[model samples]
Target: MILDTMKRRRSVRRYTGEAIPGDVTEEILKAGLLAPSSRNLKPCYFYVVNDRQLLAQLAAAKKAGGAFLKDASMAIVVCADETKADTWTEDCSIALTYMDLAAAERGIGSCWVQIHLRKDADGNDAEANVRRILHLGDTMRIAGILSLGMTDAYPAPHEESETDRIIRL
Candidate 1:
């Protein structure tokens, strides 16, 4: 059943405007915090954004594109303090995956968005924008963002087979 739940999980882009319940959101965050980290170093911090105005500002500043933040009911900003661990990125990623499965179990849809540390060739600095908006310290880094809401469209099933990607040496 756990595998089935994971199988059902997908990157949902379209969402109903209704907000996710506070308790459910809390549960999802708890699940994320419970995820295992390298050498038990938990460097992740979560910023749960439910305010529409703030969300709009974040969407614009972060350049999420395609009205994702505008339509999603809530966003979870996952950040890491680099001083806390060398593997903060990998740790945060695992936590995000846990949150995704937990949300799926509760019928809430979610999508993960990666944040970059430096501006791209066109001069886009999504991480800097996020840090400025969230008032993060210099030591903190934006790891990723999770958009959550009730889905208006069901995601298609995953097509790739993992059998060929794994090897037991």
Candidate 2:
């Protein structure tokens, strides 16, 4: 079930350095593309990066918390065209979430690294740095990056917990 998959989903940083088969990668990308968008204006874009050099560059896209991407087998840079949708952030986020869950279901580990509104180590805009590395257009606003691969560690599923946040009126 989807909920079971969600429970099993965890942010895995360390990868096994094993290459994910092309079919599995394609399936994960398809899940992102299948994500629903506001008003059906699919503005999100997914950039798959498998090159070791580019992954290392992307790992340094932000100031911290992204170095693990360098060891990932592949990464999907999620972006959206702000000119096409005002809800670009939300749209891209859903796409990333879908992809993450899909990866987990297929036994692939993944981590979401936020990029929008983030700063690089040198204080330059993280999004700009990513754009330079990926050659994306100005209109393409990055939401985040998803580092995917096989992992030696898979944490246990999350336990159920009561929450005060949910209320039915």
Candidate 3:
């Protein structure tokens, strides 16, 4: 069943502009929180944004590949307290991935918008811009944003042949 969900999962950018139900959204967020972290520190934090104006601002957080976020019904900004965990990046990534998968499993479309180590349209640090926009403290290091919504755009699933390299150790 998990594999089936994985096969169904794809990076969805277009949405039908239909809002996800409160319960479904909560389920997705809960899945993210269930992700594992190194030393069980659980440093990752999830910021849910549904405000259209805020979503538009976040859409510009990166120089490219994030414009679609403006149309998403909602977005979950994944970040972590760098001071709390050296593995913040990996932890946050796992959380975001879980959330993405959960959305797909629930018939919702999702897209991962990378922010860490990225630059904004004005060439400023994308992470910094997001932190400022969300009023997050300097210690919060953003991993990415997960844009979610209802959509009819169902891309094909990943084929085994798509794996370019898989060396047996």
Clashes of each: 0, 0, 0
Q: Estimate each model's TM-score.
A: 0.88, 0.96, 0.97
**Candidate 3 RMSD to the correct structure:** 1.0
Residue-level lDDT of model 2, residues 1-169, one tens digit each, is 9988988999999888988989999999999999999999999999999999999999999999899999999999999989999999999999999999999998898999999999998999999999999999998899999999998798878766756667878
TM-score of 3: 0.97
**Residue-wise C-alpha lDDT for candidate 1, range 25-114, written one tens digit per residue:** 999999899999999989999999988887776666544452587678988888899999989889989888899889888889888877
Question: With candidate 2 superimposed using the best TM-score fit, by how many Å does residue 61's alpha carbon deviate from the native?
Answer: 0.7
Candidate 1 wrongly placed segments (more than 4 Å):
63-66, 117-122, 160-162, 167-169
CA lDDT of 77 in candidate 3? 98
Output the lDDT of residue 141, model 2: 98
Q: Give the runs in model 2 whose Cα sits over 4 Å from its true position.
A: none
The count of residue-pair clashes in candidate 3 stands at 0
Give the alpha carbon lDDT tens digit for every residue of 1-169 in model 3.
Answer: 8899998899999999987999999999999999999999999999999999999999999999999999999999999999999999999999999999999899899999999999987899999999999999999999999999898877989776855597767
